[model samples]
Target: MATRGTQILNPRTGQRSVFLQTAQDTGGALFQMETFHPAHNAAEPEHTHPFQESRCQVLTGTLRFRVGGVERTVKPGEAIVIPPGVAHHFWNDGEVEAHAIQEFRPALNIEDFFVAYFALARDGKLSDGGIPKSVLQLAVLLKAYDRVLRPTNPPRFLQRVLMETLGPVGRLAGYRPDYI
Candidate 1:
């Protein structure tokens, strides 16, 4: 479980996150963090939280977001709300680092996902695109965190099928839900 001040750095993506309110801290109602995104960083993979809505308020620099296929630039002090199940991606396009406060409602294990994902990224277990290098491990992680995040590509039904078929095998191979 993450706590207030818990910090994670994803070198691959040049993003740093500091937890301010964790799931445990709020009895699972909310998760909030401060993010320092590197300038010129690539946009994140388009993904959606199946059951959680998210809000982001920029603190410094600028962020470019593509929410539901509409792209927009967000300046300091500007905020954006992404409804549950809406595909979205963001990147820092300014010359300086971008800082933002991010919040998620009905947290639903998102902190756990960040802990594991960042650990994997730090240890070089993930690819340049932030995916696990091992297919089995990817399947296990995706299956376990399906409620918190789902990739927009490949369709939901196909992902469900792949996870169901490979998740068990991954577990049998000693891969756990938390990569760490």
Candidate 2:
């Protein structure tokens, strides 16, 4: 684990990511961070987490959220909480790139996923449109997340469509996290 006294650094990739363990003195417990995806989209599904709950705050662009059997729209500066074990999915519903702060409980190994994705993305390891393939492996990896975190995405078919179809287009459309 990174020491709490360590200083965090920002990457040129456009993210201000930091480790909460470094903030233990500040009463940090939840995994929190702001993310900006330059023209990104989701291959997400209506799913739930077994233990984790998350919140999304739209800082820019339109964030379309579907959760708990209801669909809601969140604009800039707006937020929504997704309780654990409720079906949910979302996407950037705007012309410009989107920005949002995603807060997750227990700081679930979610950051590990992004770290891997960005590493691959940096090396052009993703498939057509930066997805690594029309079929996103990330979604597949996330499917197993059901055993660890609260279910957040939906079914595999729906996830396939969102990740393979929608996610690819977003990546091809210049959906680079740091670029936004």
Candidate 3:
């Protein structure tokens, strides 16, 4: 992987700025993803991945994060790795936005999953931390991105619910999946 890897081709594009670019993971994993500020609103919920190990590099902004049972902030230029089966969650909390890349093993098209999740969140049906104007507008932006990117399919009302939930956990639940 020359680092630039493939263009981020995932579902999260509907929200802030998320990318799941395929790359050469140092761990010799199946794919690498570059995403920005992945988070869950009230509707979005916490989740678990049964088999995949995850790694990330924080590019810009701050992310409210959790991995394996611990919570923390991953700052710019910093990187972290999450072992398989370890629960993890995160969200952005900066002025502009946050950028990060993740590595998933085997053949986890994490990109596709995020697209599904955000699409649901935008619809206002996915569970999240209550829909806010920012999130609602974010959903609209995501729909526009979908028109151009076409990541995944999630209903509109689900998006509405994801927005209504309490925190980033709701949005993330749909993204993480069984990797084993």
- lDDT winner: 1
**lDDT, candidate 1, at 76:** 95
Q: Against the hidden reference, what TM-scores do the models get?
A: 0.96, 0.55, 0.53
Pairwise lDDT winner, candidates 1 and 3 = 1
lDDT tens digits by residue: candidate 3, 31-87 = 555665434321123444545666778887767777656888888889888766665
Q: Give the poorly placed runs of model 3, Cα more than 4 Å off.
A: 1-14, 17-29, 38-44, 129-180
- Order of the predicted models by lDDT, top scorer first: 1, 2, 3
lDDT of all predictions, in order shown? 0.90, 0.55, 0.48
Task: Give the per-residue lDDT of model 2 (tens digit) for 1-180.
Answer: 333332232232323344434224334346666666444454333456656778888888877788877877788889999877677776665577667777777655555544555555556555443344424444444443433343332454675566555555565665532221
The weakest ten consecutive residues by lDDT in model 2 span 5-14
Cα RMSD (Å) between model 3 and the true structure? 11.4
lDDT of candidate 1 over 61-180, digit per residue (tens): 999999999999999989999999999989998999999999999988998898898888889988777678888888888899999999887688878876999889999999888765
lDDT of 3 at 27: 35
Error of 2 at 13 (Å): 14
lDDT of 1 at 29: 98
